[model samples]
Target: MFLMMGLMYFVVDLAAILLLSACWQRTRIRGFAIVAASYGAGIVARWTAPLAYRWADSGDGGMGSLAGVVVQTAFFLVAVVAVVGFWDIYRVLKQRPAA
Candidate 1:
């Protein structure tokens, strides 16, 4: 069940990335590009951190190790960037004149 959920999350993330990329290209919107790139980075980090944790667990005999710390830090930073990108998008929309 967890595996299926993970697969679904990856699919959805990929779809979002593609859609955002298209939006960025079509509209030439910086916020869209920033959000899409941040998401792409976050996806890579999301997939990589687990493997790093597993490797560290095998060697260190626990999750409380450097890998876990790095992963957590990366996740936090990525989340911050994602939020900022979203905020920028909101700002852009709010500033635009409605047609």
Candidate 2:
């Protein structure tokens, strides 16, 4: 179940990275590129969470829980960065001169 959920998130994150990369390439917006990279990191962190959970349930015990916490914290931080990047992109777009 957790694995399936992680896979879903991975797919969504992959798509987001691709779209943001394309947007960045077209617009040359640093924020979009940063957000896309953050999303890439997010995919890794997100995938780690469930595996850590599974390990915690098995025998890894405290270490597994700690790993899970660390990964989740990283995921949250990446999400925050992505939000800030989006805000920067929005500001840039708003400041653009009309064509």
Candidate 3:
């Protein structure tokens, strides 16, 4: 199950990069930037979001309620950014520039 989930995530990441390529073609972006943004930043940040939630409620080593609030906020921001990033990529991919 875990392996399948990981594979799905990889598929999502690649699809994001592939889709972004369409828009970047207009602005003249390097291929590496799309791959880096999609796989490195977008996917990695989305994965790390849950980790922040986990850290917010760890054992004694974890911080108090205030820290919990902060970490949860981080989690929310990361998630929001990830979603927005994907949405932006999707929007860009759908555009049809002049020939």
In terms of TM-score, the best-performing candidate is 1
Candidate 1 weakest ten by summed lDDT: 57-66
Q: Which stretches of candidate 1 lie over 4 Å from their true place?
A: 61-63
Per-residue lDDT of model 1, residues 1-99, tens digit only: 977887887898889889988997887767787888778888899788879877887775765577878998998988888788788888888888998
- lDDT digits (tens) for residues 14-76 of candidate 2: 999999999999999889998998998887776666677777778746677687677778888
Q: Estimate each model's TM-score.
A: 0.79, 0.73, 0.44
Candidates in descending TM-score order: 1, 2, 3
Question: Relative to the unseen true structure, what is the C-alpha lDDT of residue 80 in candidate 2, on a scale of 0 to 100?
Answer: 91
Candidate 2 accuracy as lDDT: 0.84
What clash count does candidate 1 reach? 0
Q: Candidate 3 — which pairs collide?
A: none
Consecutive 10-residue window with the lowest summed lDDT within model 3: 29-38
Model 1 scores a TM of: 0.79
TM-score of candidate 2 on Cα atoms, chains taken together: 0.73
lDDT of each: 0.82, 0.84, 0.61
Best by lDDT: 2
